[model samples]
Target: MAIIKVLKRENPYVQIDKTGIDDPNLSWEATGLLTYLVGRPNNWKINIAHLSSVKKNKETSTRKALLELRKYNYCHLFEIRKGGKYIEKFYLVFEVPTQYDEISSNMDVELKEGEKIFYVKVKKERNSNNLPEVENQLMVENIENKGVLPNVEKPKMVKPKVENQALINKELLNNNRMNKEKNHEYDFEEKDDDLRKIEKLFKEFGIDFSIKHKIKIKELLQKNSVDFLISHFKKQYEILKKKENVKSIAAVMSKHLFQGTCEVDSSFLLKKEQENQLQLQKEEKEMKQLNNALQVFLTLPMEKQEAIESEILKKRKEINPQIKKISTFLFHKMIVSDIEILLAKEKLI
Candidate 1:
């Protein structure tokens, strides 16, 4: 018979079952092992070193104690496959386990004395100490512009305040200047490009844009677009090249070009100008009609205008079924009416 034992302490204690203490079938060694195993968590696994309680305890004595414990059925000792071979495992079942493989992988398997378990590990290899670290992508910055001993003191960025419209404009101007400087590092190339365009335009117009003319044209380009100045140059070149000079070119520019009186013998330009004026007049007349229509439509009730729009759109479908929306239908019809008036005035189809 074994005697039940309760080892008590100030802050901790262990519960030992009286069955292991009083059972006559268990030897003293088995009883001691059973008492130790029963006091542990039911899911914990016992090892040889755990059975021996001391660092220098003999492995043979621990093995015999385990064998004595197994004979009395206090726990289970079994073999299982781990890393491809059979290995002995102990399950502190206290009672006989129905499932032979009851020892789970998560069971608290005790380690041998002096065994070190490192949860975190350092890889053993060449330069193993210098492992790569992850960092934020946007946080990386150039240190060269931050000044001397930059690593000692981080560069502070003070946001430029915009308290008023003038301050806001000043900040925007500074930002634009910086951006222009950085992005356009080739202003000379841009100037050369403009000169190339001017040369090409002169080639197209069958004239030499002379060095003096080039200087004057570059000055003009500061305010006018390349196409606008070049077109005007073409017009003046045609009139002055007929007059026997590029310096005489200034005559047309100073007198007629600025005053909108620069007329050339070009039937094509005249025709295009007339068409543009006629188109402008047509648009103005359409706008006037739309305004008048809007006034009359506004006088009617909302329902009446909606009904008239429906009827107008349905009629417009006879000309082109593609005009689907009421707004587009009315706008197209008004434009067509104005175009008809303009055609009648010009006596064209």
Candidate 2:
């Protein structure tokens, strides 16, 4: 395949570190999500719901990508509390992972009057046996003597001896492995329960699910709720019952449950058209009956119409005492219904 590339030099571009984009630990989804988040303005509020609302970004996928970012330290979630009550939570995005504390500590040295604090930054080697780097420090001296204090000799560092360090490490590793296995077993049981529940649902609908159906249901569950899946299944079954040559409901469901496209036969379309026509005819008959009732009510004496309206209002208030007012449209609609019942009893319509 031939490839063509074009570059655009524009102000509407985000500058991201190549390290994060090319990180092996992150998937493409996570990398793209990170870049999108980093490009937003500093004051822009961050939220999962808003992020998921973007085109082609679903809540499930966005949440999974966020988990990946959090795992690699590309993002951090913090909760802000006040008066020991939870206020809100926020996320912090980083170009790369670095070791630092959220809250900074003050220097232990005392400051003299009229003296300024001189802070220093130190870069330490990664593997060197030295103290960690300090972000801020004050260089203070005893001012009473009018001279800088002499440097004290640094204490020699020592490593404690552990006779069974190797055995301890092995035991810890074994314990970690056992705990992981237990967690895995629990997860497997939960998945089995979900699968069985889905199977039970299929059986309740008089449908048998195959291995393929089971796998598809698992995938559907990842992006949809069980209720949604069941609703779709019922709709599909209802449609399939009307279509001829549909041998297996489960087979058809595996293809079209949550996001599948369905094609109905001409006969099914004809049947649906007939059903719609019947519905329209039924509505027209009801409308004619209602209009006849309204004409009869209008011809009645003023006192008779008022009696019907009062009866309706009394019954409605008896049922719901909180109803203070009714709209004109609804009141007339209810008046028409009461007139119809009254005329029907008198064998008028």
Q: Which candidate is the best by lDDT?
A: 2
Model 1 Cα shift for residue 217 (angstroms): 99
Of candidate 1, the 10-residue stretch with the lowest lDDT total is 1-10
- Name the lDDT of candidate 1: 0.50
Task: Tell me the deviation in Å of residue 68 in model 1.
Answer: 1.3
After aligning candidate 2 to the native by TM-score, how far in Å is the CA of 254 from where it should be? Answer: 54
Put down candidate 1 lDDT per residue, 1-349, tens digits, no spaces: 1111112212245644476688877767667666565454423444565656643445555565555555455544433344544444333334222222332322333445444322211112242356453442111112112322213576899987656879878989999999899655554455567767987876665555577656665666667887886677676767666654356454555555335466566666789999999999999987786556555554667685556555654544323222222124333434345444433444443
Every candidate's lDDT:
0.50, 0.61
Model 1, position 37, has a per-residue lDDT of 53
Give the worst 10-residue stretch by lDDT in candidate 2.
Answer: 1-10
What TM-score would each prediction reach against the true structure?
A: 0.23, 0.27
lDDT of 2 by residue, 147-203 (tens): 233468999999888899999899999999999999778646756777777788888
Where does candidate 1 stray beyond 4 Å?
1-11, 42-46, 53-57, 82-84, 95-349
